[model samples]
Target: MRPINEIIVHCTATPEGRPVSVAEIDAWHRARGWSGIGYHRVIDITGARLAGRPLSAVGAHCAGHNTGTIGVVYVGGLAADGRTPKDTRTPAQRRALAAELMELRDRFNIRKISGHNEYAAKACPSFDASAEYDHLFEGRERLFKPIVDHLLQRGDAGQFAQSWRDQLITWRENRNQPSPLLSSQDPDDLFGHAVEAETLAFQRERQIVADGVVGPQTRNEMRLALNGRPPFSALENYQR
Candidate 1:
């Protein structure tokens, strides 16, 4: 597994799905006077996973985590018909991403799955990867499910996303195993720890120098990450 443990996601901010070569992507980054294409992979509109900067090279994707994690960019930001039309990823792209993630998981034995929202304050990827997020934090405790339903307000959102919530629970458990850090004793009254951790992860991923605190922008990322996944009709424990 090459000491692998985390999967970080990003968005191209455009749905063009234009297959830009790695060299070209690098050139663009150079023009900006920045490092290289910040991610480990890029999934185009057709769902083709364009392998990007090598993980060994230390990517520019997620803020601080870039030092020790792999990054993937899915074409287009994830909020569909979002604050702007630019924020949508094609269904084909989504399928490609699922495949890529599965492959990466198998090949690298990656443990944590988190969106840009989880790492830092910015909504770089624009899509939700909450199931993985939940999994990363909760691990294998039976209490994971109950925790997700409470944190995400499960009954209000659709079934597909809720399913991911469960997947997050399972995915989290598979990689890290149980730890007291995810103790059921924590207060679930409001955002509190959930919001705090998400904010901190975002701050670190985005490389934004700031203490972790939930604000308007952070809240937006939370909504996007939690709401982006499909709410399949067959999902169980879905309230509405």
Candidate 2:
């Protein structure tokens, strides 16, 4: 393995919840007249890590820091409307990113890590990765929290919220866990009392804050437990 000095984190700058892959990035880079994908690795929203440029070769991610720095980009940096910069990482992405960073640090003895914004005036990552991951050097286990897109609660009905509730139900059922929130016959998407109860129970079981709200932490933990499978692959596939 090539000796690396710094690890730079970046974002794909796509809309929130958008799914991107290394192949797509490779084509984009090729269009830009670069060899291929600039980053060494790209982590999709579902937490799937895809290999990009070879680690043995120099990176083209940063302007001046390519020689000794490895670039890692996560999909999704834009807000819901897909224009504004935002920290749009999902729970799965958070865990996978933390793990990948830790692995890189250990494997390469990397001492410095920063977001793409730290070097350039642009907000590529759209979050302070250095400060957010500062706990890693202090032996912190899990460093960052999930990026909450919305809060799912009683009477708050929407396709996104409903999809989250449905995901919660699917994750619970798949794990062979019984939840009153789920219907015995079919999957339900309503955010009802049972959903709140199950959400609290899930949170408590995972030692998360039992606030009964599908906030960042709760969403993160749930997706982590679910093993970060693509929550809506069908929709994503259809879009593709």
Candidate 3:
């Protein structure tokens, strides 16, 4: 794993109460010719923790400061008008964000927690993340294992399954290749035939083993597809 020392927070810049999926963000970044989503993690309106770029890779969220930093984004920053910046974090989002920051701080021994506004001339994140989370750096116990570690396959249900399905659906939409199977499914929490078929299709497209199961390799490839490959040359410069 790459050494990490900082966590930078950002906002999706979407209007309040608007739901933004991790895949949608990835598609946006990809439209800019980037590999995928710039942040490493995303917190949705319902406080769902969505994965973005892998922790081992450098993020594209910050210019000239991507190295050794993990990028985290919450789903909303814009007010109802969608023009002005605001602290639109829901109560659940606030709790979730604090928990996530504490976990990362302990897990990575992070030294800093900052907002995008601190680094650029933008009102991203819409709040003082550094000041809010300054106490996280005091000290804490670390977790020995990652938060989630289970292969998503047919018959699985709940938040993780739903999150992955959301990502798959968004990716297909972004590619302008909508999946009829996925479209017909409601609730989107169950890993049924539609999800399995789409998973198989994605694996084939990525040229990985088409097992139709979301294992470690498949998950990594999904992230790679979203973020593109790591810029080794740029990382080398940052390291030096």
Candidate 4:
């Protein structure tokens, strides 16, 4: 056990939905003068998980933070059409992905799950895990609704979770960045309201009275979530 701490999700930037070989990934990394594939596993459309990097080492998938994370890539089905419907992670692949994640979750004591796009700001997965990944496990949406809502508000929470959010916040603070916070009054637009809604939902779901406010309780959940210990409330009514 090399003390794995994080699991970062990604999509092959390629157009095809086929399984990729280890050699191909290796060569891709080598060509960039990197050590190896930036992911620990690559899940093809058929649900096969191919190991990319060794467990002992960190990957290079996410730009800012890869030293403590495990990267997993999936074959992408996203088309150039710009609509997300055409891109889907096959059920078999999703199932395999879930199983693989569970194994890693147990092995490494990981608690949080995230997509690549969230970390550095690239939509490699092309689909929203918050929006698309819940169906694989029934009633999962309710489990992740708060987290998902918060992430959705940022338009990149599916990928970043909290680690990158903290990083982004740090970046903003360092640069004296003003909040690009969107308007939250309109329920329909609810633009940039994911974090707020999610925090509130999480608190309320935890029987803490979800005020839709991001206070200490919500921040604590986010912290624990990044480490993979989602609140028990999230597991309720969730399909295994």
Candidate 5:
């Protein structure tokens, strides 16, 4: 599969309540001397997801950043006047968009979700999609703050270590992975060798640095794993 790392959201720019089909979009793009519908996916007023350009082909939606990106467009972005930009997404469309984005993110390990306005001067999506979907890329960072702050390791023994162990156990159990703590060992507040070994295994599985220490990235990955989401990509320098 081609490497995909970003999802860009757009709108049809049609008036509110007007329905536009993917075939119509395809004809429109063809008239403009393009292949077909530029977006990878389209959502209509009824919140139905329609296939557009095949994902194997690079999208033609964005001007310069088509490669390694998927374009998703919702049906309407205009007010009743059909000129002014507005967020015309209905409740169903909102839910559908969120579900689509989450599925795409997990499938492709997408690094960023952006609105068309983020790249251009016009308000194509008519809303702040990036800010609205920010939580989709985040982990339970606040819940893992204690482990992150203390940097738990083998020699550590405290409530924080115990909390980490508890979370790790939950993560393992959720995935049906064998628990690292021995059966004879009590659930104590200690980060022992077994914990360290398990930490290394988890880090390796998540594609994180296998340092056997609970740092910020490790904790974030752990939280995401426990929540049934994949870890973030290692492209730390990615802008968004």
Candidate 6:
């Protein structure tokens, strides 16, 4: 309701295998003479996402940036020794967190997602979240047409079928050294050998067949690799 724009992840800093609940977190905050839990949500060891503070109110999780952001706190962040900071998220928690974040992005039009360590030095989440999950923030769309549609059945020369070539070039180039020029110059058609080679290389990198054809399989693999970003409205068309 406060025009949420960012989703921040945090850790409870508790030791691995320890069980903590939202009720306990609420009591902790109440003891401090504040509202209930500071975060909008809490994820437990088994990856159960629970509600905490209401979305209608400003959160108390992050120090200075709580006004326009949502906070998600996982139960564990410490190592087995219970002192050293470590990413102790379980596999279930990882999946649950991704799903929860996706839902939040769709509902609140979230633009950016980051870990607590990005804003503070304490390594609250104990991992480089932004770098690791960068692909998830890239808005990747599935190709509506098959790659073979653009290729000439008899010869290698053909018009391109994909309009996402520009986006693909941008995405792939950002991952590696700048090519000075993109392999695909035409946004609407495949017109260059460099583009074909680049497509082949991308297929190889994704472990798919290196046929240099951007077909359904290639498009699916690309979508998976990109993981997509928040909805377009979340960043550009957001009314707030």
**CA lDDT, every prediction?**
0.52, 0.73, 0.77, 0.55, 0.78, 0.67
Q: Over the full model, what C-alpha lDDT does candidate 4 score relative to the true structure?
A: 0.55
- The better-scoring model by lDDT among 4 and 6 is 6
The residue-by-residue lDDT of candidate 5 on 96-174, one tens digit each, is 9999999998887776788989888999999999899978967522332110123678999988988888777777778
* Segments of candidate 1 deviating more than 4 angstroms: 15-24, 78-87, 132-240
Off by over 4 Å in 3: 139-240
Q: Pick the candidate with the highest TM-score.
A: 3
Q: Give the per-residue lDDT digits (tens) of candidate 1, residues 45-129.
A: 6677776665554455654565446788777673444345344667787788777777776676565677887767877676577
In model 6, how many backbone clashes occur?
A: 1
Q: Residue by residue across 34-135, what tens digits does model 4's lDDT show?
A: 444667787876787776666665455775556566787777656644334234578887788788877776677665566666665667676665344433
In model 5, what lDDT does residue 148 have?
A: 10
Candidate 2 TM-score versus the reference? 0.57
lDDT score, candidate 3: 0.77
Which one wins by TM-score: 3 or 6? 3
lDDT of 2: 0.73
Winner on lDDT (3 vs 6): 3
- Whichever of 1 and 4 has more lDDT, that candidate is 4
> Model 2, range 16-80, lDDT digits (tens) per residue?
98788777887777565454677887789899877777666556677656666789999999998
lDDT of 5 at 220: 66
Stretches > 4 Å off in candidate 2: 138-240
lDDT of 6 by residue, 7-125 (tens): 78999999998999877777676555334577888889999988877766556677556767788998999998999998999999999888888888788766677888877788898
Among these predictions, the greatest lDDT belongs to: 5
Displacement of the residue 135 alpha carbon in candidate 6, Å: 2.2
lDDT of 5: 0.78
User: Which of the two candidates, 1 or 3, achieves a greater lDDT against the reference?
Assistant: 3
